[model samples]
Target: MKNRNDKQGNLPPEIPHKKRFIIFLSVFAFLSVAVLIRYAVLMLRPADTENTGNTKPFVERGPILDRNGRILALQTRLGNITVWRPDIIDRDVLSRDLAPILQIPAETIDARIESSSADFIYLKKQVEQSTLREIENLKAEGRLRGVGVEAIVGRIYPEKRLASQIIGFVGNENNNGLAGIEYALESELSPASVKAKGGSGNQVFLTIDSNVQHILEEIGERIRRESRAEAVMFMAMDPRTGDILGSASLPNFDPNDINSSDDISRMDRPAIWAYEPGSVFKVFSMSALMESGSVNSGTVFVCDGHYERISNRGERVVINCLGAHGRVTIRDIIIKSCNAGAAYAADRLGADAFNELLQNYGFGARTGAGNPGETVGYLSPTSRWSERSKPTIAMGQEIAVSALQMVQAASAVANDGVLVPPRIVSRIVSPKGETIRSYEAPEGRGQSRRILKAETARAMRSYMVDVTSDIGTGWRANIRDLSLAVKTGTAQLIDPKTNAYSPTDFIASCIALLPAESPSLILYLAIIKPKGDSYLGGRIAAPPIREAAEALVDYLGIPRGRNPQISHPGSVSLPLPISPVVDAVVPNLEGYSKRELLPMLLREDLHIEISGDGWVRRQAPPPGSPLNSDTVIILELE
Candidate 1:
């Protein structure tokens, strides 16, 4: 003990001192390196800021923003309130204390605690920070016990029902996306930079504009109410860039109350529901027919209310038209929406060639709109066509399509034959505003796609203009002097029971391209099973779209090609759809536009309080209120 140096000199001869020293140095170096790496990992890991025995604060999931940086979906500061069974002494007292704050019944909370499934259960999930703080303070002060808050991310849709179907909603309190854009962009939306830290996740920028989305929702809701249809599908797109301005399907559910909604109510119809498109198919078929040189602008055919054809299989096919189209050119066929004429035109292109053309036109496939559960649509091979299948499909029947596919196909016509793939999210940005990734199309518009010739697309657009003209079937779609190329359609719904078309059910639809000279926006609208007085596409589907598009033009500040002196230049107010007065004596104000009624707003006899902005969707006093002093009229606009 007195001399350690003397003890080392007396060590066993079998073990060399230098060798032992070398081994000890090597072991020390390895341990030192391992410790340094572990320290670095601990230092670099995300720091949890909450001090109340919680690992992290809520709001780790990134925010979803619209094209202009408006928030759509995001995470809020809320934590899951859980109960530890062992810590809980009196279940009744705990439940009673939480009932008022959590907005849950005491019985429910008590029952959950009593359940034998798990020792611990969430008393309330996703409670605001303020509420959780109060509960924690009470627990710390001995006023409460057993209750704990687990800081976890909570998904919030700020816009409520606006674009709800498109943005979708998360499931439970896990913040896991269950459908739509939420599911489609989970990787981008989920936290990657931090395991469970606030404000560390990336943000997704969509091509949608909140303003545009609100307008579409309003118009689609109005159309649904007027038509008494099951639902309406509406889409708006910037053809040049493949930017989806709006995708709406009504009736939609509010994301804030996701559990209350059904699958049918939350469906993204434009991408999910595929049905026969009726006359809207003519746009694609006619474009293909013209693009293939099978039919030219000058090509003419006579219609006598019927089309007769014989297939290679010795099968005869007969098709009926809405009316006799007489001698018509390609323009006339579209303007009049002549089903027989369209079938004839498709017949001229031959089954194989026409089918190929339509397939290339973006039908029979998904439009790549980036929404989950997108349907590719159904298109039977030409080889499988029956004697009548060709003509039926030619007229927009015997085939299935989604609204997204239709709008994407129509973009080719609007963009001068360029087939830009439809997309929702345009770019992703980090929390610090750094660009992570971008999905926008390149500078050159016509990059890898030319589904139609420039001239052919132009010709098709021109024909659509006639569709909204006075002489065309889409007269209801026409806005006075508004430059728009549009086509309207009405298709019978097929009965699942009989495998035949339902006589009482129909789908009314229309597609429009604004500023017809050089198109910019492509708007498509469709109503399913309209029960309104007029089931025609021109009647039920066109008017609401026309109104919606006009509102869009105003909000977007899209430049009109015409003179500068004009204000509200595109359209005159639409005439009333129904008779305004009950007795036809009160001077009906039912069908007048807001601009047309501004003069009446000055009248003292009638005190009219307008409820909303946009076209007059409804009116009070039955439009027949007797004219008198102090007569208050309530007008509702969409």
Candidate 2:
């Protein structure tokens, strides 16, 4: 190395280069170390000081709509008030500050904050955005610490308690369904269900007619008040389509405040509750006896207040009637609701045949209403029947059935012996309004089957028409010039505590098939444990059934010319006006509410993409554009 020192007293250029490199390295290492220290400090910091956690992934859930496109349940963007427990910093001060904002007692807030051991907890959910802004402002001012908020999807029920028992409420645990349609159709309405099928799902449409549902609720409320019963239930269905048009249960709860509702208020009595149907069961029994060729309309029996018979095992069975008739025909027995006469008729039908008929009529099986907690009503097989079983069952006692089951059974009678299975859901549609699938009963289900001869059904209708006459038990149900086949029932309730029938507890019920000649609507009503001046079915349940029928008849326009249903499978009827089918071109959707646009959007041939909220302000290609795969009707809402 020629000389380490530079010439003319200058230092070596290499020395300066090495010194510069060392200095640059020292600076870089120091910067790296500083960065590492800062990162470690952050990792060690307490989470309370940070506004983290409490964020639930925002996934869209489908809406619940009525058959007519009325919104029943929907999801909206809302905020959740969250708090960092450790960061509460000052529990007393924070609770005091939050008390006014949360509209709760400061003591309550204080207790909540002190009870939690978690680093984070939700103070409240579904808080309004405007309300959250106030909280955020207070937190930024250092007045409220350890407080955070998460934007969440909130469920809302616009109809309040209208169909609470049927729609069900969502539980806080993962927002799963707890009961009603919400529970039954959970897989179709849940976020995970949507993901499993695709990215998003179509809305769920129920066959429930909102107007008719309102009518049932109105009439049922009156009956519940007048009878002072423990509870009441009313359900109406279309016998032709098995569509439940209206349903109402007393003591209903508002799903919006489900946490505050009691168990009884949330119960869907029509589908879940079972009771002895009393005289109404006679209708099916008489129909069965007549159809089986065991008895005819002119078949006569003596009822001297009671009927006594000897069992095959030598046991004696005796049943009492409401009144003694010396000689009664099958038609007279029905008109008078004679228990003894019915028992005599049942004796001729034989136990095996009667039980088989009841089972075939769907007595011992669930109505398959697609609802949860439905009881298949108790109908013991002939093998399990006691000596008194036949007579007791003929009088609508000793065997239990739900209101929905009764409706299904009556639908057969009104439908001319063609059993139409009941269905609650109509179809599931994509958000763009295209139908993905229909809920029609598969293969054997929802399909009609001949259960009895049309001639027998007509004779039963004639006897039922007399039931609304002046001397009939269902006299209170008479409407001038309104033709209907009706039956009334009253059975003493079996006290659960004693497992014995209690005289003080009785269920009054009534059923009607309108326009007796060619019935389409079937209405069933029951008042449980009625305590009034009169507890008879005619006095307690008949008038309300008439009122409901009148309202529904007007609402449904039932008097219009109609075709009688066929007994063959896969037969169809035009009982109601069908909604117009969607054409390939876009229809004019202007001046329609967002809710009204839903039915049109549900057309399978249309692709609708909605933007913003509220009514439509602008749309692409107007209303008559020829739709195509690339055609996306851009809807701008204001």
Name the best candidate (by lDDT): 2
Candidate 1 on 501-587: residue-level lDDT in tens? 998899999999986646779899999998956898888888887898779887877654321111222222223322334223345
Candidate 2: tens digits of C-alpha lDDT, residues 244-329: 98889997888877777998989999989888998988999889989889989668889999989987789888887777877888
The 0-to-1 C-alpha lDDT of every candidate, in the order given, reads 0.78, 0.80
Clashing pairs in 1: 576-591
- What is the Cα-based lDDT of residue 392 in candidate 2? 84
What are the root-mean-square deviations of the candidates from the true structure over C-alphas?
14.1, 15.4
TM-score (all chains, Cα) for each model: 0.72, 0.74
Name the 10 consecutive residues with the lowest summed lDDT in model 2.
565-574
